[model samples]
Target: MTTTPRSPAYPSSPLPSASPPSPAPSSSALSSASPARWPLLDRIEGPADLRALPHHGLGQLAAEIRDFLVTKVCATGGHLGVNLGVVELTLALHRVFDSPRDVLLFDTGHQTYVHKLLTGRQTGFDRLRRAGGLSGYPARTESAHDWIESSHASTALSYADGLAKALGLRGETGRRVVAVIGDGALTGGLAWEGLNNLAASAHAGPVIIVLNDNGRSYAPTVGGLARHLDRLRGHGPDAGVADPAPTAGTLFEHLGLTYLGPVDGHDTRAVEAALRHARSLNGPVLVHCVTAKGKGYAPAEADEADRMHGIGILDPVTGRPPAAARGKESWTSVFAAEITALAARHPDLVAVTAAMLRPVGLHRLAEAFPGRVFDCGIAEQHALCSAAGLAMAGLHPVVCLYATFLNRAFDQLLMDVALHRLPVTLVLDRAGVTGPDGASHHGMWDTALLSAVPGIRLAAPRDPATLRELLREAVEYADGPTALRFPKATAGPGIRALGAMDGIDVLRRSPHRPLDVLLVSAGVMATPCLEAAAALERDGHGVTVVDPRWTHPVPDALPGLVARHRLAVTVEDALADGGIGSALRTACAERHITTPVRALGLPLTFITHGERPELLARAGLDAQGITRTVTQSLTPRSTP
Candidate 1:
């Protein structure tokens, strides 16, 4: 959950560097002046200022913003390619709609940097996703203009529908509700559900559904839906265009909604016009706009590195950087390497993703064995069941999905996969307090939800190397369904950090005194546990902190470990119900080692959007929070 600001090939020592105003080209100069080279974009403060500029200058502004985004994202690590791809669409939406009043909902808010920049957040772009800085995704709390604080993919259409219905019920008028969704998001079942309902609407309310089709989700999309999209994209919107007519038009029409476009998304004028036309329509309408992912940047455009999905900061002029320095490899990177190696050995080994080949680091496997790797568009449920069927066919299928999004496929994972005890290796990425992207995208529930599966063996790796070993182990374990959960942030220094994973590291030594208190922490929060131990040690409280890498299966050594201690504390980043803490309490109760056990985790509530550390701190997960809670628990209860 913590990231050190270490950049590769950065100015070593104090080398002379130019204080250059970002290398990206800015909007045209405003006549002759002292700062004649200054860009007009820097002068514009907000949307009103942007509106003041002529339409001719908007393209220049988008270019300036793209340059600014590239420069800033390079410095502060966050989502890069998705934002760059949607510059024109973001700019056009703001220019057309009166946002904050006219609800503009961003699907999978990862692509909202330009939306943020236009809505008076340009000044803060340099510090995006950094702790206490701007969030990487759209957060309603951040600004009044941001209507929906969403980070999870494929849910905005539902929000848009509900809001539209609410507006109608309240007799609210004049406001146009627009949902900017991607081709990737369309793969989710919720989007279809919203589309089905919205398509069935009787009231002719003005709702604009912008399909920002970039043809890639996390990685190059897969499955029938993606192929259907290819037909639509290839055949343009011409009446004579063939290929049995695309699904968007007929599919929505059958469901009773209007369908428009296959418009050129890169051209702001065209997109703006299409939006205006959709706004003029009575009921729900879909405006399909096609744009290049990583639009203007040549390297991003030319490179096939995960569909130019995103990469680390590069020199603006050359778009070149030295080979990504091998620090401790991330769990995702390790998964990619290991999965590729595994697939090479076992012909039956195949990989599947819900349109997240790149973000989950499955791009290498996807590239190596194109036939073996399946990018199942944005449909998480379909991806799960498809993997189940593959497993049934004697092929080992690994479904690599983000933890937050995989919640949509719980029923499928339970009924279709777990019911049959299918051997599907689910690699759940972003399984904790995913920094910056906010609450919706955070993978905070997989442990609790998947833990209940009858045959599922849930495993979480503390570091990258363990992740590789665990992934290989899970794939080969053909008896039942298995899952490995990990967070979104760069993987910490691997097995070396844990010292030993031979049945949980007993970090704090309280050998002399009878072990009175034991703290069992899971996943990435172990770092804070170590800090909390130091804090508790200073207060003369003996603490034994254990990182139980395998929280479920309730490690065999745990009973003896718990028996040795008088009080036990179980902490996890997940919710309390059915989580590590809950499991620990159950285990203690079953083993008859009462010892006054306490569970510490996220409160039973739907947490809102904010900086990751701030959210965690507010939720009593920080070192200070842990220290206070542990101290309070040690206090004797009043009889009254």
Candidate 2:
């Protein structure tokens, strides 16, 4: 599918002034209105007020709410399309159920902006995804209304099951549990697993599964199930329920939940009526609500490319935002260019992604060589296994997945691919502190996970050039499994000539002072390390910063570098456990080099949502933190 070559919108633009509807809430009217007012939601302070108003006013309110969201998110920058699609549904949800009592959970959490707007967080929208601002995803820490802090897709059902089960266990049956899942999320195996478990439980609680069918994933959600949804939605309400065969039809029905939908999700009354009916019924019932991804927005409506899956800043009038000027190429863009370049040279070269194409920058490869780029739905396991099979068939399979999602195929990556010693290159995108999406999406665990696989060589490049070089080396090295990782953001000017043999390279040096500390940084986190080294140098301590292009197996010349310095520091964007930091410590221990080494990365805890720099700083992976750690280690300890 050839997408219109439109310039991509960037997130850097300042949001335009929120054109709130005329007549802000008056003091007397606000006091007279219901006390259960959603405080932060100035536009929609209370659903009680909405229910009290005439039906015609409800539609007007929905329009105002959409405009409000657009304005708020434009300033803050958030999941714009998802929130846009759910304005009416969100209205209906608020209208129908008494929330805080009725448990409403968002599937991928991107659609929660509307929910947030309704639940007294309208002002917080201005700080959306910012450093000290409100989070992009729902956080229990943010509000009591937010029950589950879900950012990852395909998890609402599981959360619903567990919550519902726990409610039953506690003998608390007063509340209604509603889970809003998306069509894209249905591709994940966990959704099905949750469905099966929910079905098997004898003592079931009040759980309503709302399937928000948008007919799109990161890419146009590919699979037989997606095709089935098309048929179901196309059949409309007139298509009465009847079993064609003896076996339970539909995946959800097969799992034993009462399947009821293909409803017009855009229509507020229809969705509310369907939801009201589902609420009346006991046990688990799947209510499939069919809605457009970028609903009510003209430009997004015209957009065929995966329903404009979250653009940068957008223009309110035209729905087209200012694009970021091209500077240094992003790691994703670099990877895509190199993959396309390599694919042209070797016919055997093939690329695969587990639902991600545009985000991973594989769109270029898909456009250049359409036949070779295989988007194996959202099934990461299938993608990895398929890559293994492709390798067995003499094709160089490059399985591209997000750092977090690649964890799903660990077994397949180990036994099927690595054990077979297949020529499979796993390209892990978003390999570090992923800025706004929160802990669930961070690619921090890939290096550690992939490192455990015997014979699997892991290459983490610091820049675009080394990324290209590593890809070439990975493609050429037909002996065993090779993995490459980069950050969620852009790659800086990477030093290619680490050494003559393309091994570890010392990026920066200090001429004035002695080499007191050796800072080893991997992947995109090297930038901060360099800055830290510079800071230490000014403080009268010389620091040698090195980028071990390939983090796994610890480079041969690294020992010599370590021996030269009195203090050593291993800095990476990954988690401290089993990551590059651990590897360096182990190397020092094994080599019998008693260099006082300090390991710095993400701590052994789940981090919350924030901007990239803020999250890094909190994790102690930022330049200031790195300098402090190095400086402390370099200082002599006094004993009285």
Candidate 3:
């Protein structure tokens, strides 16, 4: 096929004006240089424009797109490495197949930056991740070409299978479904489950599974699947066990499907050829393309660790973020230091992370005790069940996971660990309302989920010192499952325990012994709770602020404390429904205490991506929001 250097998709859309470099104190590293214009990219308004380009000029077009990615992503931080890696592969697919009639889905949509550009959403890059900005992930509202609105890993094959089945039932043979899944996604059980169904004769015909293998997810994917992929590549550890010269038709074919490739993903023509060959087949086919993560950008290519999987603001030329650093350690870093110390004291202590070795702060712990740490890959359920087994086998296993991911392992947490009453500790990082990755990312479900599990205890650490202190307490409590959760932001000013009541930390006590409000703070909300309490006190209401460090058990002293105050208020960072506040109210009722208790937290809704502080304020979990709520609570109700 002949290709033109330009496409009519862009429709002469001029670039958005470049903003000045952010202040040293801001999160971005923009404005060191202005954005560049690409006559080639400007012409690319749709797939038709991309198809019109000469096959030889397609290479230059890929280069221009890659350059555009680095410039825009550096100016406004997003997934830089994955987008850089998928340029040629994306172009090849778009060039070979007609979208809309042919559905194209990205498994974990972080790599869809190039897709968005080619689909006429190029101008949305400027406001990426802001409230009204272009979403960091795909949205059904974005375009007709974007068929699915999911960012979860390893679920694409299942979606494709369902779509393929639907098309068969409706006799829509003209339409096709193409799923582009990362090799890193293979570790998840869903991928295998989908493959099992897709390989069957029932869902056969016109389903192309494009396995974009870069060999890492946050880090190198850790599982049997990676080894199988290595064998499929031929002449890599354990090659002779099956066939010395194995191809895609080897392992996947054994499952009753055709396999094609070991194709150079960077070669546009080669990828197009592979895709074309797979598209012609009457049954499901797997086209394996091996590419480098962070393919073009020098900084990303040189960085071996995660290939800059997700990034903050940075200089375009050197890829340097802001010179000023975060003032304090993030909750994950704090957990890392404590876990390292705990590992030193206890020989049986072990940690497990699901594919996120670095992001969850297990790298140092893994380095210190190589034998004790395990990376289960993007497989959360497996990690939890494995931790349960480790706990049963005379080991103290701590499952370090992101709060958003913990929801995925509810079954394992309930049946495997909680039912057995194992002494496992779950360290939850990025626990509440994480910024910028969008709705699917906010970790606001853990407290609610754990509340339902019998014998499970959850702790929300409010500050750096409490995280360290509480994590140690969680480790020592070996009778049942315990979780120590904290948000992604920097640890705030520490609030010390002035006194203890049934394992609760009394941070502040009103001089007027009889308090107007019993402020029960669950985890990271302690700082805001204290500020809100001060505001209440200045307004002539007696307030007592306490941090229920071990919040899950609903401290025995809490009901009695609640009875002392005229009213009780519980503040948390989790979802208000079934969260700490609701739990506290139920506990209060169970103890026959009738103090008017109010629950303050994020309302039941999908919190959009933005800075942590800004999102918190919007959710009414910040100091001012809390203070305003508390003040309104004190007002006398007018009879309507």
Candidate 4:
């Protein structure tokens, strides 16, 4: 199917009639084993092929694509529900606009699986999100059709605004710039900033903003904007009997952009018609497309939590993750239980999350203390600043977020919380080399970033026991801000400390030997450090392994301990520069200690997607790699 080339000038043409609808296959037929023959899907390899097909064949092809996604994505453990929901929407977008020439940008990009399928990358799903394979989000290296490689939300509109402005400057006004943003991404402050700017730019070419309102970001969306969208979609008390008119002075219209729809996103013809109407308009236009997250799959739609927004390897038929994947107690679960218990004891204690009540393990706190926990939407910056306000009111607020997401609120953490010396505890989950989600999702930058914040104390728990102990210590410390971070993996059995000294825990020691080497472990790195120390001891070298529970302040006893040992090495899963290792090296230098200090951690580069163990090993942060590094350091080189 080819697109009709439009004139360079803006046209005031009427909306064209939609094609006749085809008979949709039954749910049973669609869900039954992958079809031996996907006649329409197999024949189409690109957008041109998709546009060439008869309009009546689109429904059957969508069904075939869903079945293909279920079989492939389930086997590889990638995003399922979001991709399933956007099948028709993606089809409508591709059908209406020429992709490469007319830029199409996805907000979070996880919903682009259908776009990948339509753009001839269907076979890459077999290795989805694997190292050196197809990324879970859009990647520029993979296809020309994908404009931005985005996983973080609420930034697509800003990108669209910039691209539209650039195209207008180049006299390429005929090229369209479209941004599809949703999954509660509009709740972010950045989205509003982009919207405000886009509305202000009256003649910045044609920028079509597609609002895919699914009414959820992890759980149902929160706050006033969600309510406004709900009313616009005819689901709230403020909505009257009849649907609102396109130019009824709605929020988008007031913001200076033309408003259209509350269109049925599942209907291919309807969404296509709405998009066509949007393209015909001049300047920026907003098309509100209402869709259901996990629309077709019964299991995903029935999932009360997140609508299977993300999943591990799961049963294709039942839509259930494997028993083993669910049975393990993860770091998030441990924090959930401990935080809930802590909330019961402290009435003045409160919690906040950035539209991630369940994902960051604040659901339990929200359940136990109904009014105490706040879902601040996808606005991390707002969450941090608001937590500071809570602290000012003589209350301690614990803000829970994924370590990667905390990057968004650094200015707030530094200026509002640390500068004011407020009693706010930031609990960061997934604080290390997060696997499979790719570079953008890794939680590797928190330590380096947090180190620069004055008056802030950071803790890296070694195990479940330390996580529980440090959490209580952090909340009770009323002098300044504190943060506790842990990895995304399961919290294994507790590692008993051999002894304690000045807030540091000694995990292992060489028997009856001089202090030849000191291993300073940060949080979850204790296990591998202990293993590497054992290997050094077996080779007849004295080694000591210790976990500095609070890694940021550089325990008062650390410089002296480094002074006693012949060599000191710090191990962490965070970035090497400005991490615990760098801090310790500086501390020893200040105290006039002569011992050599070495730092071991992830390099300052975008590590690709892979399993946790595999990625760690590649970065030389695993047990074997650590042992090798230590041995190599001890080997003296001849005078050059």
Candidate 5:
């Protein structure tokens, strides 16, 4: 979505005569030429330092902060566009309200980088989104100013509601709770729930909801609410009319909130005035601030697709990643190509995404078959139930989402799709230990959660070929709900199957030596499992590796295969507890198989941010780690 820049009617009067605002900080003010690029930004150690700046100087400081953000975030990689958009808004918020005590909560915390910088965490940007460095989203441990830590969308308002209630009960009536929710976040059902509760509980202190309308989520905000917001903003300064008073008949006003201006989010003075007015209300208020997602920066502003919402390390000036990092075929690309091809072949096939049309690879399908793709806006639960409806009709629905986000729609998937035994295929991208984005962003929990679904068939692809094959299989399976999950990493070369036993694809076999070990590889775990098998063979043990393309339901031949081997180990890029390994173990037990079954996967814990390989190795799911585990299992141990 292209954001139309608005020319706010800033005050035309000259600076005051007494206590005139200081001029923008010059480079000469720095102690040294080096490490002093952002002289104005360098001065800000906290919100107090920012608040101390004069009004005129704040504009220059905002520019410096944007420059600082681009320089630091481009090198480290982060939510650059959103943060860039909120520079002045964040400044205005900190200036008008005292944080830590006032309680400023940001929905979809990726937009909190500016807030982080103003809160004395500028130095941490050097290692932004890295292991043992700064987290991508707000972390409660990072600073007292950061109250909540969630990257998930549509959660901040609910947090604000609860915080407001707690503050009221504690008799801390002076402390205000502000929730800065985006138009994208507002589309979710939970956000409406919070709005409903906040409106109903008129006694639960004042809550200033700053609607940061950047006109986009991963794409442009969709549905009825977006149109309503557009209507509210249509009659503003951009329309060449006088700055109107708080308009009535707004969605917020209808919900019992005092509706403030569709104020220019970039205009510090206007936003500050609006926030102050909101703070004075002593009840629920909404200050709708219209912003350009990639304000100021030429490259980001010009970007049509997502406006660089999230990015890898890139050249700040060019706003382009290095050649090596560019055009690399990822699992998402594979799915995009396959899905587009599939859509063309099947006229009855349709796709659905939860405000992540582009991120989850449905953009290809949407482009190819325009009317067939549905953009459900940050509402995953609604997406699934709607998909269930689509299935109940005649069309086959492929519901695509990030594996982490799939957690939000579990109940819908179970009751609506699986219970009805509808033909729905869930394409779960980033389905395993996704790196850098941290614990909340990781897709490691999907396999465990999906395993609990009664009639859901889950498939984990080992490579691009298998991904394409399995996706077609999943879409064609009209028996029940089916899901195809893959990681965020590049889809490497396909692993050629040595043979097939029932439905399992055997990748490796030890012919000469006796059947000693069976290696069960799930999805992309085949590569590492093969390495482990080769290592075991060198250590004088017969090892066989297999991939159950569809991992759920426990392949019929699996228990029989396990019975032939002395030990059976299932390796997956998912939780060890309820993952494919757990399913296989149960299957073997049911068949009275005597072979010892070992589940080799991620531990039941919140995995921190790091490189995918490093995290996998640390969890003993890598080739070296898998080999070590097998070797240890083969070795004799003395009694303690």
Candidate 6:
């Protein structure tokens, strides 16, 4: 449990021997749930407690822990499939290496649920990914055991390399560095950049890279790299077969890292022994631990789509909610339906996804036109640039991604996509304050960031109908780049337009009386803007709410509309700084329109995970909060 590596491990540092290799757990231990509850799991405080158990007892402990996770995640609704997949591998890791001091970094930290549970965070699971509770990913603030806090994939290898070098430089060479990376993550360019560097520095102390090949990142990992991993697993390089000491033969060996394993990731004893061997190697090494994406439970195994990668509250026994689901189409579903329809009319339309087909709702598009969809693995940068290629090749490519993930490809978006003025349409799902999964996962910065990109037509759809219409319009615009951002929740009922101006849709009009407030709503903010308008009317303020449909370039129609009202307020879910309202004010000044415009939005701070509406209200992006802010801003200033 004490993975805190000892002091001064020189080049030929000796690997610590914990105990003899434990016997593999019997099928009964894995197949059938333990009759007794998590007695061993409850007793265990941390990794040390779990590690101290005898070899045979480890199986019972793992079973207890797995059962505990199933029960806990069923109620709490967290990353169920991933945690279940890594149970035995996690046990092996705790057995092989000490944590905290050893610098055990996890790529795409969602897989660290088992790691967290083992590292004395079992108690934090009740409110997992909830407000003021345990984060969905590894959090350094939560525990000393955690180091890197990035939830994004494919950067752990780089951290491992840097940490290894720093350890050597600071004479903390005794501390070992191990990066537990997924095969899916290995597809990212950043991982390869680190690999290229780490391979070149074979002589710079030992750093063990544990390749946890789960064969997935939201979906089955695609491309040439996955096939290479398959060949490595088949050849049994990880089973202590092809020693990298003399032979520079295997792919990893050529990369200057010793190879070990096709180790059974499900077999705790085998993985422990293989890791121990890897730890003892003279130079940098890779321990390939092939694990199933959803290993233990039948429901997770049977469910092919992402193996229920992440899910809502579910019945423990059936993996289903008690009642039938009810709601209008979600934003993702709407995009899926609309985009698929767009593809039917436009044969030249193609869909591109960065390893997330189902999550971003690209499957519908893929189904409509099978080969037209291209999954570019976990490489968002490549996804964007390649989408530019598709656009340049006389085809309209919709680059579908989560709003948060799109942040990874900003450079590509600006340089490759925008500089070339490609007609690629970026479809960003889960825009605005994503409810849970914590700060790192929120899609808060897209609006501010995208606004800076020149010639990019950004469309924020407020409802299902708008999304349908906007997508059709975006695909048809071949002059330059376009993006359509939508929220995660179900789309609300459409608000019919009261009237139309230059290009804006007036959703609510207070024409009977003189308008004191001009409420400019961008995309999904239309709902709250109308609510705020009603609230303002009750307080003797006649508010006119308009949906610009497109918020970028500071629409010419907007400044003119704002001139009619005394106080112009632009509301958006994006960050207040450098957001839509700021853009409007700047645009109005350029056009010589003197109306005072105020930006109302979420503050430029890390908003915590909570219910979407609750977070919105807390951030003053909700109706009551907006009304309160506008009322306060409109109040006459006291003479100083």
Using all chains and alpha carbons, the TM-scores for the candidates as numbered come to: 0.82, 0.87, 0.92, 0.94, 0.93, 0.91
- What lDDT does the true structure give each of the candidates? 0.74, 0.76, 0.82, 0.87, 0.86, 0.82
Candidate 5 lDDT score at position 21: 23
- Model 1, position 111, has a per-residue lDDT of 86
Quote the lDDT for 231 in model 6: 65
User: How many pairs of residues in model 3 come into backbone collision?
Assistant: 11
Per-residue lDDT of model 5, residues 1-640, tens digit only: 1111222222313212212221322333322236767778889998888889888688778877777777778788889889889988999899999988899999999999999989999889888888888999999889999898879999988998999999999999999999999999999999999998987785688999999998899899999888787777783333334335444256676667777777878778778887887898788888889988878777888998899999888877788998889777899999999999988888879999999998888887887789999999999999999999999998899999999999999999999999999999999988889988989989999989999999889999898899999989888889999999999888888789988989899999998898888999999999999998888899889999999899998889889999998888899999999998888888888888878888999888998888889999999999898888777776443579
In model 6, the worst 10-residue window by lDDT is 1-10
What are the runs in model 2 whose C-alpha is more than 4 Å off?
Answer: 1-43, 46-50, 235-255, 321-328, 494-502, 511-513, 538-540, 618-620, 635-640
The predicted structure with the larger lDDT, 2 or 5, is 5
lDDT of 4 by residue, 1-640 (tens): 1112222211123433433332223446546655464678887799999999878788888887877877778788888888888888899999999999999999989999999999999778889988878999999999999999999999999999999999999999889999999949999999999998887885577889999989998889988988888887778987874546543446777677777777777778878887888899866788888888877777888898988899889877788788878788899999999999998888889999998899889888888888999999999999999999999999999999999999999999999999999999999999989999989999999999999999899999989999999999998999999999999898998999999998899999898997889999999999999998888888888899999999998999999999888889999999999899999999999989989899999999998888888999998998898888888877553588
Of the candidates shown, which would achieve the greatest lDDT relative to the real structure? 4
TM-score of 6: 0.91
Candidate 3 regions with alpha-carbon error over 4 angstroms: 1-36, 238-249, 635-640
- For residue 423, give model 4's deviation from the true position in Å: 0.5
Q: Could you give me the TM-score of model 3 versus the true structure?
A: 0.92
Candidates 1 and 5 compared by lDDT, better number: 5
Candidate scoring better on lDDT of 1 and 2? 2
Residue 464, candidate 2: C-alpha displacement in angstroms: 1.1
Clashes of 1: 0
Better structure of 2 and 6 per TM-score: 6
Report the candidate with higher lDDT, 4 versus 5: 4
Candidate 5 wrongly placed segments (more than 4 Å): 1-33, 235-248, 635-640
Could you give candidate 2's per-residue lDDT for residues 324-352 as a string of tens digits? 62365678889988999999998999999
